[model samples]
Target: MSAAYRFSVSIMPRDGILDPQGRAVEAALPELGAVNVHHVRVGRRVDLEVEAGTEAEAWTTVDRLAKELFANPLIESWQIESQPVTARMGPPK
Candidate 1:
């Protein structure tokens, strides 16, 4: 990840969330000729574009942000990764 500069932080639940949208979709599945589906739940992905000096710093910034804001430490788990920089995308110095 050393060569990486820009990072995308993805925050989502590790267990599950009871989603009404998912349930509605699941309920409709059987009528649409799809069956045997015992479980269905919905999860969302949050991508954060952040600025940092180094790859390590980028990871650290997002990690802290996730733990502090995006994720609820009580229920969900999250992960992050850095993307390859094609060209400078952050605010110009």
Candidate 2:
């Protein structure tokens, strides 16, 4: 039987790569009264649900998607965190 799983995918630019968004945020922070902050990097989180017979199967599915579609393998790296869903929640109103 397939069970519902929740996955949180985090995508970020690899270290040493130029992250313009991160640089922009870092520049703005000091002007906004924040100090001593450095090396700020911007990344994204994607929450998704999958149904599969086992945790491995669900991981494989999301892993493939993250590699092939979600992240740019050249400049970005990705991580996945998964957990079994005890109960499903309805969409936000």
Candidate 3:
């Protein structure tokens, strides 16, 4: 049986890249009493599930998916974090 793995993809703009949304949020932080917040870069996390026989397989699947759909390699970068999903079976009813 294949195991289900949950993977999280974090997408962020590359260093020295211009992030207009991040800039806008940073500009508003001071007015909201978050003066200490600096260089606030905004990013996104996407969670996905894959069924595979091994961790390598799951990672490979997620890597391809992330590059194809989650991140734009030209201006942004992505990282994948994953864990196995545990399902507890109760006594047969």
Best by TM-score: 2
lDDT per residue as tens, model 3, 1-93: 787777888999999999999999999998899999888789898887788998889899999988899999999999998754543233322
Model 2 TM-score?
0.88
1-93 in candidate 2: lDDT tens per residue?
A: 887788888999999999999999998997888888888999887778888898889899999999998899999999998744643356632
TM-score of each: 0.61, 0.88, 0.86
Root mean square deviation (Cα) for candidate 2: 2.5
Give the better candidate number (1 or 3) by lDDT. 3
Q: Model 3 reaches what TM-score against the true structure?
A: 0.86
- Model 1 clash pairs are none
* Per-residue accuracy of model 1 over 24-80 as CA lDDT, tens digit each: 879899898889785665555555455656667778878887789877767667767
Q: How far is candidate 1 from the true structure (C-alpha RMSD, Å)?
A: 4.7
Candidates' C-alpha lDDT: 0.65, 0.86, 0.84
Best by lDDT: 2
